[model samples]
Target: MKLARAIHFDESDMRVYASPARTGEWCISGGFEFSNWTEGDLTGKPRQAFANGWLGLETFGRATFVAVTALEPAELEALTDLLAEHFVTYYGAPSAEAARPVAQEEIGQMVELCEDHAPNTLLTVARELTESGVREAYRVIESSDAGLDQFAIHGSLDDEPHHH
Candidate 1:
């Protein structure tokens, strides 16, 4: 696929392509590429498919992320919200619970744990930034196929995680 944009975040490297799949849809796919996790490796990623399934992505992964239900242009926002909500329900610890009273050493270990786990990093990235990322992407898409190659890297969160 011709990569239109690439987002290199804390634990994930996502590339958004100007999809040749469908007009109003996006092609979301990627995975935990254990063997080759480098600067420009697409091996471990998922095959480019339309945004019409429970996209459980993993380049080197979210388990059943990016739902295809009720999909629309607004679905991007809805997907981000649903992902956050799912995290709140299943992710064990919500981002709101991040400010727990703990020893400095414990903080260090948790940080290390996240660093060691790609899924953990993905979750953290999801918690921190998915909504804004989707919004930005939609903005570009709405601008037209001409606005296809707008790549980006998100190294920080724009706001606190949402819960419900």
Candidate 2:
């Protein structure tokens, strides 16, 4: 299977995000973090995160970019468990048992997004609060041999140091 991992090009993510995700952590849209937001809340590092950051499953932090990568079933299961616990601890979910399916669905949404893209393809998300609710759009940047070097955040997807 495939999913996305956070990639950092510089310290911008660290500086701008109140809690920036560590490079190489698994990420998801994490728009759930902003479900209660209002136009008034759109003002600072939180605003920057709501604008485009991907949420890291490990740190519950924000990331500006993510790269598609292979995933093992065991790793996916582990992530699912971690996310479920997060919902209980942070969002007041009744229990990890009750939250597991929702957590899986969130990760599943990301899985579907990456499923169509090739490994190492970069992805970014943009969101805005609309009249009805939050709106999100994704941009995909497919990797190319000529330009891949530009994204030094990722050395080679096949390289061990970048995986994790």
Instruction: Give the top-scoring candidate (lDDT).
Output: 2
**Candidate 1 segments exceeding 4 Å error:** 1-73, 95-164
In order of appearance, the predictions have TM-scores of 0.20, 0.90
- lDDT by residue for model 1 over 34-99, one digit each (tens)? 123232332233322222111231121222222111223354443344434434454444552341
Candidate 1 yields a Cα-based lDDT of 0.26
Tens-place lDDT per residue, model 2, 39-100, is 99999899999999999999999999898988899999999999999999999999999999
What's the lDDT for residue 123 in model 2?
93
Model 2 quality (TM-score): 0.90
Candidates in order have lDDT scores of: 0.26, 0.89
Report backbone clashes per prediction.
11, 0
Residue 74 accuracy (lDDT) in model 2: 98
lDDT of 1 at 128: 13
Could you tell me the lDDT of residue 37 within candidate 2?
Answer: 96
